[model samples]
Target: MPAPPPSRVTIAFCTFNGAEHLEDQLASYLAQTYENWDLWVSDDGSTDNTRAILHAFAQAHGHTRDIRIIDGPRKGVAANFLSLLCHPDFPRTPCALSDQDDVWLQDKLALGMAEIHGEQPCLYGAQSVHTISDLTSVGRSVGAAPLALKTISFGNALVQNVVSGHSSLLNLAALDLVREAGVPQDIQSHDWWLYLLMTGAGSRVVVSEREVLFYRQHSANAMGAHQGLRASMLRAMRVFGTTYGAWIASNTAALRRVDTLLTPQARDTLTALENAPKKFAALKRLGVLQRYGIARQNRFGTAILWLAVLLGRC
Candidate 1:
């Protein structure tokens, strides 16, 4: 079921070194089938042509959405996004996070906005488009699916993230939850932290396989398409032990910042995680192989996810 249009949204766009395709991206947004969005763009000190292009776009489409080009000191991807969310100019209702590179489908905004409404402050999901060696391959479709509530259960929520910063839409109420819980400014990926906390906070992480955004896989992508088993194993080994701890610590600190932003459900989730066994052998320490920590597993699955996480396979 395609979701209905959100009454309005303020699109938060962060760009750095995005000049090559900047115009294309802006055009896509301008061409959105659904209107009613203001654009908030922050250039992370791009030495490239990104600034000029954005300036031109704003001059031409000034009224498209209260376009504003602001100053950004290139904090980083995670921090940059945090700035977008916390920016005072952003509207208080529903907000959509956008990326500089991806091409937006015509109905992307309308489709994502529909699901973001309702009682729970839900997070809409995204589909990936694999660009292998310049070949753009079609992946997930954009047709809406029923938002699966149980998919984001507390225990299961601890492991993987469901929200894509680029394709996601966060409701105002969820903003309250996020503000209370505070995002870890110093984490591996901002979206992943949002996944764990928001899901645990009783927000629905709806997996809308509907392909609205074209996930461009290139040398610059933060995450790429799955590599072979050997590479995966090596990366998992690296991630589980030292890498995982460092990541958790960074994210934990970010969580502490937004501790008050947490909802009751989110607080309980943090409590469970904090109280879990010291070794954290379940999912935190190991990769998968428990009933719900990493990936629901027992003995064999644990080892499997362990290897996967270690090798970057997961």
Candidate 2:
């Protein structure tokens, strides 16, 4: 018997004034080893040559690749990606998210597809190599550590995101689940929300050991790459501030809207997190999170998470 045909992939790329490196990123897409893929982009009102570049590339490759460009919501990066994910025209195939400035390895799509094909409602992600804006090698992205399936859960996603959107691919069933949930207001990050929703719904989440892209860091990055002590300090500040609370509130509200979709265990964990902070003692809240197995990706990061919880910050 003959083998099945390759699964078609739809690459959802969100752009915002990424002209400086857009060509390289697009070129990398054209060089992908996977041939059965299309590109759909939503631009968030770029003032630079981003629109022109996309238009030219689409025109040049339209015969070979299905390329579509549309206007974005202009709310922010997360919103822009959500717009593409929820678009009515989005293909019902395996979908991958793309950053406007990252250079994808030739095998990125192929690798993701290979892992995600047999698993319905699955999410596939891998490590990324950090690079300077000029494509100069810096190092592997900080916390690009191996992802253990045991560590992936709605509880952990509530505290941290282990999945990088740029290197992630989701099967059609996962996409349908997200679209059914709809876009939430005040979402802190699209990738984090995906991780939460997928795991919460008892879907499979796979993180490959391979490195698949150059994660470019630049001045204009909505969230630049940060490593080392300085990065830790910055993360602490964010977790300890009112912003973290707001993020929690926003995510919790969204999760509640789709509460029925989650497994019983995940629903209970979400409820616990929602009610934990109401306790008068910070240590009590921290204990609640610990009981639910909420954790960050790394040991040091988990320590900071515990600290933040103890301070009534998480």
Evaluated with TM-score, which candidate comes out highest? 2
Q: Which candidate wins on lDDT?
A: 2
Candidate 1 Cα deviation (angstroms), residue 301: 7.0
Q: How many backbone clashes does candidate 1 have?
A: 27
Candidate 1 TM-score to native: 0.79
Q: Estimate each model's TM-score.
A: 0.79, 0.94
Record all residue pairs in model 2 with backbone atoms less than 3 Å apart, i.e. clashing: none
Model 1 bad stretches (over 4 Å) = 1-6, 132-135, 138-150, 180-183, 224-238, 263-269, 275-314
In the range 13-97, model 1's lDDT, one tens digit per residue, is 8999898777777888988987888888878889999999988888888954588888774778877776667666666777777
lDDT of 2 by residue, 84-199 (tens): 89999888888999998899999999999888866468988888888887778887655645644348778888877778889999998989988888888788899889989999
> What range of 10 consecutive residues in model 1 has the weakest lDDT sum?
141-150
